[model samples]
Target: MENQVFESSEERTFQYQSSLPSLPVPALDESLKKYLDAVKPFLNHKEYQRTEDIVKKFEHGIGKVLHHKLLERAKVKKNWLEEWWLNVAYLDARIPTQIYYNFGGPGPYLEHYWPPKEGTQIERGCIAIWHTLKYWELIRTEKVIVHRYGNMPLDMSQFRMIFCTCKIPGIPRDSLSNYFRTESEGECPSHLIVLCRGRVFAFDAVHEGHILSPPEIFRQLAYIQKRCHNEPDGPGLAALTSGERTQWAEIREYLTNLDPKNLSLLEKIQSSLFVISLDDSSPNGTPEDYTPITKLSLTGDPTIRWGDKSYNCIIFSNGTFGSNCDTFVADLSPCKRLLGQDLTLI
Candidate 1:
């Protein structure tokens, strides 16, 4: 479905949030029956019968109590399992997020006019950045249309993490840092971060109360690229994000303590709208053969990618594009869909 922007006072993107139904807790009996069905293939007749007996016992005893507690929780919370799911599935994982937990894919433009063309990286990247900022504006103004399943509108809260969000590491578990806010809610971060040649640069996407046009963004990107080519590389602090979660957390804390300014710099990256990675490698692969591109996008340059950021747009030297993003923010499908629509804007 095509996304429509609604500028009228009566319509807004998140209008359905309040009216949407809360997530429900399934019955214990239903869950137990599904568990039995799942285990049947793995167990023989005797083993299956013994496992079934244990499951039935639990279903009648502690399972009923836990289910009742969950039902009580659902009564108070809109989505009872959201925080638990995020923690268990993402934040608490100790593996390197870059190649393991994060998701990436080949650029959507590969099937169309934009292909691997050397020296076009900054120019095409500026256009993509401009459209991405426009998408941010649509969300800020509440003009973007709400997504629906049939007549029912789905929750749009996760859209906030699409911009101005980062995942911060901790000792026991990581945490999400989100600075997104609609115009009616409050002010939000409008700065952009560019990662090139192991150096980090920040600039305001909104200048003089308006988002910069493609030409303006191109000037900024071109300047960063040129400086990166001319000068010595800055410390690749971003590579820390590719390490194990607890290790990254300790290193980040050490850096912060080494210099108070380091904490400010970290905040800048965490609060920026999103990251634009200017990659030097060009994985020249067509849409029909995306293996090369996908591999590089997910695992190529640790120095150039902030593995924990909610979104990172990777612009290769040949003008091809790919994205590496933390799954904790949102899944790849919706981001891909949004990028597809953003390309139409371009």
Candidate 2:
């Protein structure tokens, strides 16, 4: 095989998107058979028989109609699962999205160059945020090396959603808000949202056409951390975003009706670039192992997590980092890969 070169990274990255095979709609009978086989462990003989009969009916009757409709829809769309997945797996799910649907992991930084250091959490956090902004810039500029599978480029479309994006709760469904843009595309929001002690603050991450210097980020983060320590606790309204969908919708409605100012506050939260969680817990780990960092990030204070946001950098008091994100795709390697690479940059 000879090495291949490209004039533009975008061309190489998106080369396979149009040629990639479409998502196949499985045959109803085959899928039903697999379902019955999967359920055999949970059901007794008679229960299995009853389920088999029910499955038979579904496969032949209304199930056929539904499958036909799905196939019809697939004929019109390149990927049928896109919208249905958003609806069923995310929007329509009644469970709390943070614990139920979100994916989280500890920063791979501790495993590499930067280890836990007392009193440097904010400093290190700013560094991580800076690298993350750089990663965002890479995505915005189509500079990320194209991921390939067996000589073909995989889809890099979701990179666009990695920053300046959030899920907006609504009645019966939720929608995504993405404000990210490249320099050539147009203006995009360049601010960062800091979450501390249930209160939120905003500051521009991009200062004078560049990501803020580590010192500037340090000052901004220090101010928020100090205010959080001195002031009485905020409403911690972000906790509501972790609630079940319908419950959140109702609570959101009540909140909206309660005060006009609340609506603006919610908008500010849902539209920010990303969230930085200033955690009070000191989840420590040894030099070689960092598993506890991830465990703590997912199980830590619920009030501090904005689960619907695309990214939440959970920074512990000891300068360790873990993260929670509303990534829904099966392949979550992109996030972990990006964060892992960014952890060692500064």
- Residues 1-346, candidate 2, lDDT per residue (tens digit)? 3224233544534446578777899988889989998999999999999999999898889999999999998899989989877887787777788888898878746545777777988889988988888777766666666766777666766767878888877778887888777666788877777778877777777655777778778888887788778978777777888888888889888887988877876766776788889988887766666668877778778778888899989998988889999965230242221121101000
For each candidate, give its TM-score against the true structure: 0.92, 0.80
Predicted model with the maximum lDDT: 1
Q: Write the per-residue lDDT of candidate 1 for residues 1-346, one digit (tens) a residue.
A: 4345555466788888988899989888888889989989999999999998899899889888898899999999999999899999998999987778999977656557897899999889999989899989988888777877777777878888899999999989999888999999988998888888888887778876699889888888887888889988877778989999999999989988988877888888899999989999988878688887788889988988999888889999999888999997760342231121110000
Pairs of residues clashing in candidate 2: none
**Model number with the top TM-score:** 1
Off by over 4 Å in 1: 1-10, 331-346
Error of 1 at 219 (Å): 0.1
Lowest lDDT block of 10, candidate 1: 337-346
